[model samples]
Target: MANYKETAKEVVKLTGGKGNITNAWHCVTRLRFNLKDKNIPDLEKIKKVPGVMGAQFSGDQFQVIIGNTVVDVFEEVEELLGGTGTGEASSNEKEGIISKLMDGISGVFTPIIPALAGTGLLKGFLALAVLTGILDTTSGLYQILNNLSDSVFYFMPFFLAVSSARKFKTSEYLALAVAGTMMYPTFLDIAKTAFMDPSVVNMTIFEVIPIPYVNYSNSVIPIIFSVILLKHVHKWVRSWMPKSLSLMFTPMITLVIVIPVALTVLGPIGSYAGEYVGKGMTWLFDTIGPLGGVVLGATFPLLVMTGMHYSLVPIAFSNRAVLGYENMIGPVNGCTNIAQAGAAFGVAVRTKNKEMRQVAISSGISALLGITEPAMYGVNVKLKRPFYYSLAGGAIAAGAAIFFNCRSFGGGGMPGLMSLPAYVHVEDSMNVVWMAVCLAIAFFSTFILTITLGFQEDAAEEVIAEAAEKKAIKNGTKHRVFAPISGKLQLLSSVNDNTFASELVGKGIAIQPDNGEVVAPISGVVSVLPDTQHAIGIVGDDGVEILVHIGIDTVKLNGEHFDFKVNKGDHIEKGQLLGTFDFEGIIAAGLDPITMVVVTNSSDFVEIMNANDEGIIFKEEELLIVL
Candidate 1:
């Protein structure tokens, strides 16, 4: 890779420097920036930086694709910037209520995804173990595992209180203390008694004012509202309090004043609000049946595109909390996600663009894991038609799911193929089967629809020139080589090593090898195998010249580390093992171990089109289209 520090500096500069950036966050593959002014950053300049895969603007945030090494790059960038500006402000553009609500929900919940997903996976596994009789409930092991699985959800108010406090800009400890009151033993006991015996008269505050007997365990809205209220109250209290007494008295007065008000006002209001919303949703589903599912599934993709799907997160939890099972959100999420994957797969199969095909396949797998942003932004949305196809497919599958009465007893972090086991009802193994059926329906529907609808071909001059050249070479006219190693594909322009980056070794693609082994890219006679064995030149059929340079500066090792399988003038077929080098040794020697497969005689071809895809490549895979 290029010097990461230099890349960081360039990135910072191109993003209008540190001052222009308000906030910076990253997912697996991209660094998302909230900029003070979107127009200030130069998109093209950022994309041209070595190590950058691509860049784009999405949903009011600017994104820079950094591939797998995003974390390291993010650290470097963060250091260069020192500190960032305050968080995102609401958009001035007129947005629907649904859109605004979803944005707020996403802000509150996105920070806790790691904790949520880990516990959700654990719960899914625990459910599977008990249902299958692998673990008895009476066993000590089961009890410990059960607590581990339940703790997150049982005390969800505390977790949400902290996260929501951050989002609402309130005191975190104060929020937690407030949340604790909702789960206090006395309150829980009173709530439990009221739940079990409707006729019992609950104890009242001062024996005059009645307390709302409601359980806030595993509740969503109560904690969110409580923290939001805390934000305003804390600010008001802090403004007038003396600095010496501010820390102690502000918290004391805020907590003393907020707790009772929360229990008497905010808590009851939020609880009732959640309950009615759940009831309303249940009524809608019951009244409309399959149409409700169809509407949810079809609109889900569009919701996600606008960051509005998060609006359903609380609704799903509320339904589970009030009705003991959620039939709407989980099933529809699974269907929509599967449909996205299916559409991406369809694009992979139908598209002739190798880069598009590669992105489609990888992003499709990510979609199956319930992380559809890659599939959505990288493939389906980019292609246009596939996104619509996915939505249509999701609609049909959701209707089937609704008909089967599929339900999730607990909130799933992400409703995907792996988390389908979470849908298994204790008394019904068939629920899991139904979930699978829905997923299959979604996959097939979108896949078939995408193929039927097709994509508008991108035939830029370079693509057209490359296609014509490939055609000319294929019909008994010419020949080409393949990739020499298994690793991630990179452009020659993106390579870190100076000689390769400068294209002094001619034009071709680079491979960041995962293993030490190297193989012959094609049938060729080794024309120049140096004594050091760090580089090899091959003369393929019809005089196609190729070079395989193993490492950036491995020549200093002087043949000490390389194990050559073939010598100069040896004819090797495609996929033949060339040799293995010590990857660890190269690292120890302080040399970059990125390998380059270049067409040394590039001017000989009408056009040499490197595969534009950025993904893992295997030996003998088509690496370049040399005309």
Candidate 2:
């Protein structure tokens, strides 16, 4: 695998460096960067990076697709950016209300997906276990597992509090405090009693002012709005509060005001809004039937593309909470996901590009498992016709879903092939059968359609004068970089760090040094010499940028046992000494002395080839060819 750290650096570098980023966060598969200048990064080069599956601009977010390892890569990127990860985005950029809303919804909902998906899947399986007679609903284990799966959804406001706090840039604990008020034991008991008996209505705040006893559990908008209110309230309270007493009194005063405002006004408003929206969707779904399914299913891919899909996520939750089941929106989303996966598989079979085939197959499987961004952007959208065909498949499958009345009883996970059990109706086992049939239709129909109506794929490495390019390989106009240190030459992949090994920064080779001598790889000016004295960057006369890092992670030593002969901008020739490190000392410190010599600008060239394979070599031996 390409080293994640290096891939991260390359990702950060190609996104116009850390300075260009205003905010950085991630979703299931992509590293999302809210950039200061969206046009700065080279999207094409980012896609070519070894670990990046794809890249694109969605509004102000420059999304780098890293597949399943996105969290790992995002962590590395966070380290590179220091503590500025997820800082407040620049408020100056003008975006439509929908765009901002989508961004906000995505930010708030993304972090909770793992909890939701896991619990949701478990909920489905528990139903299966019961349906198969392996476990009884009355059994102790079944109840415990069932409640455990239900916990996230039952107390959803708390999760939203934390996530929305991060998005709105407020205190998470404070937000949780507000959610606590909404879900307080007293408040819950009163709301239950009031619901059970209509006469037991209002809970009074101050004798004259009555706060309605509304159940805020399983709620969405209330906590989010409370947090947004908290952010402003916290700031205002802190503005003039005495620094000495601020910590204690500020939270107290802030909460005293915010919670009452939330309980008395905001909570009721959000609660009613959620109910209306959920009821409205259910009514529309019941009334329109197949047309409702068709519209939602076909447009889902587009919603996902623009991140507008998240705008409906809150409504789905509300639907599950209020209506007790959803047969309208989410199942259609699952159908689209399956359809995309099917189309991706078709593209995998038909596309002659080896790289496309690799991406298609991997992305197809990911989409099948419920993550569709890879297949959607990497395969379907890129191939054009497959995306439309997949939509058609999704529309048909969704119509079938509604026509058959396939339903999701309980759970909060993405609808997909693995989540078929989510449709397990305790009262009607046929729901599962119908759900499976719908998904199968989505897969097979899209697969058949994609293969039958093939896309325009690039011809197999067509006559680029391959023979001629090979014959002109020795031309002086091409660039050559000599070995920088003496030892056993090895492929970059042999190095421990993935960044160099994966060639994500650029194509290069590694050298396991026998001695400490480091020399100029090409005759040009020294471009970068770090204060740490562990690496050197040189620009060759032919414009090939070469970076020779002395040892893996040797920068941690703070320049100890290392020396450089040339400063930045100094002239250098092939084999001329640039620096030296204590190879034995780095080894004693448990750091590898395997140096990586890379062409940092490898993307600008057609090919970057190593001069020789693994063997002992001197600093004077040819190391790389750029053509």
Candidate 3:
């Protein structure tokens, strides 16, 4: 793999040297860039770079789809981009109803990926062992593995507590405290007693009067509902308590108020709400029956793209808990994932671009492993055609699933091949049949569609070239100047931070400028100007691209203190007025607008040298080097 630092530097050079990259992190795969500027970076070159698979923009963040080695690459990228890290900001805000709903669902579910994958793998292995007769249910090994697999489900509240705390920006310990209340030994004991003897108990101790006990372990809604209420409880308690005793008294009172409300109302209500939602979904499937599968299959790809599919997890789990079986969503989702893999395989078969072909093949494999983000974001979303093919295949699989009356025997989200054993109930022997049919439809339909569509080799090139050209232009300019706010001018190379000094993936000079209005360093054609108004990209007379990224991932500021002076594609000259900005207002709004003068097209340059020192720089001072 190419050095991650080198690749990151190239990216920064491509971005015109000025991007406020506040934070960087990675998941099992993918290096997520939370850039200050909202402009889409050079995703194409980032993909072409040796270590990267592909790059994509999603959910107000930039995701670089790297495979298993993403962790290693992330370390290198961090080293190159300085080590400063920031917490991921919530994507939720005032938006359209559907958008907000989607954001909430994504936020709630993303943190659970590790648990789901780990448990799924264990379950898959257990099934393999049983099928092979290597282990029997009566064996000690079976007991051990069963416990391992079941622990994730039993202690799900703990997992959800941590994830929900991050999502809600609340104390993780506080969330754990709330989760503990629900899963406390006393609570479970009371629940067990209540189940055995209905009339004996008074109100539960947490409440004024004895109430019926409900088991909260392995439950989803109660904890989430409780945490949501806890946010308000915490906020209200903190406001009134004396400073000295605030910490201790606040949590005590918050719990005193919130816990009872949770047990008395929210817990039961949320549980029923989940149950009803699941039933409603099942009812829709029943009414539609086989046709429902086909409809869902067709739309599943789009739903995944928009991240709406996560909302179905709670419904699936709830149905499985309540009915000991789940119908509809899981089967459809499995089919969708299979269809995605099939489509990617098709691309691999048809495409000649070595890079696209490799990505297609690897992405297909990853999808089969149950991580579809790489395939869905990198290959399917980019190609557009494969996504449609997956939709068609999904519909076919859905039809098969519904025809077979497939039902899940265990609780979970999507049932893959590994979890198939748990889903097989003797009464619903049709599940096996449906599984076969779904697999067949998903695989065959996508395979055939991809062959029919063939690979559009030309399309990939068009996109790739456009992306590369943008990078080249951004990096090619000589002597690019920047406005230093009447303060010390830090050489672009002297910023010491890995992201700036090493030029990993973004470009521009860092300055401790005197606070004032930021103007265009060297005017050119504006390439990108986002709605957030936090940054602008300009292409100069020399075919060099310069991006003036105004602030550090301040897109979240919602355009509060920014004013744009140029439209995309507008032409201007040196020292031209770009726009007026509120440095103090942005800071007051809790944002950092660090202006960077970057050369987006750096590939054409033989060498780059920095000229300005720790002094005030006029608008046209010789600040950068180009050969």
Q: Pick the candidate with the highest TM-score.
A: 2
lDDT of 3: 0.68
Which regions of candidate 3 are displaced past 4 Å?
A: 2-100, 192-210, 352-355, 409-433, 453-455, 459-627
**Ten-residue stretch with the least lDDT total in model 1:** 459-468
Error of 3 at 142 (Å): 2.1
Query: In model 3, how many backbone clashes occur?
Result: 45
Clashes of each: 0, 3, 45
81-126 in candidate 3: lDDT tens per residue?
A: 6653334443334345664454555566665766765664576467
Predictions: Cα RMSD each: 17.0, 16.1, 11.7
- Model 2 pairs whose backbones collide: 3-498, 3-499, 6-499
- Candidates sorted on lDDT, descending: 2, 1, 3
Residues 170-288 of candidate 1: C-alpha lDDT, one tens digit per residue = 67889999999999989998899988899878566778767788899988888888888888889999999999999789999998888877888888899999999999998999999
lDDT against the true structure, each candidate: 0.79, 0.84, 0.68
lDDT tens per residue, model 2, 295-316: 8888889987766687898888
Worst 10 residues of 3 by lDDT: 84-93
Q: Estimate each model's TM-score.
A: 0.67, 0.74, 0.65
Error of 3 at 124 (Å): 4.3
lDDT of 1 at 463: 32
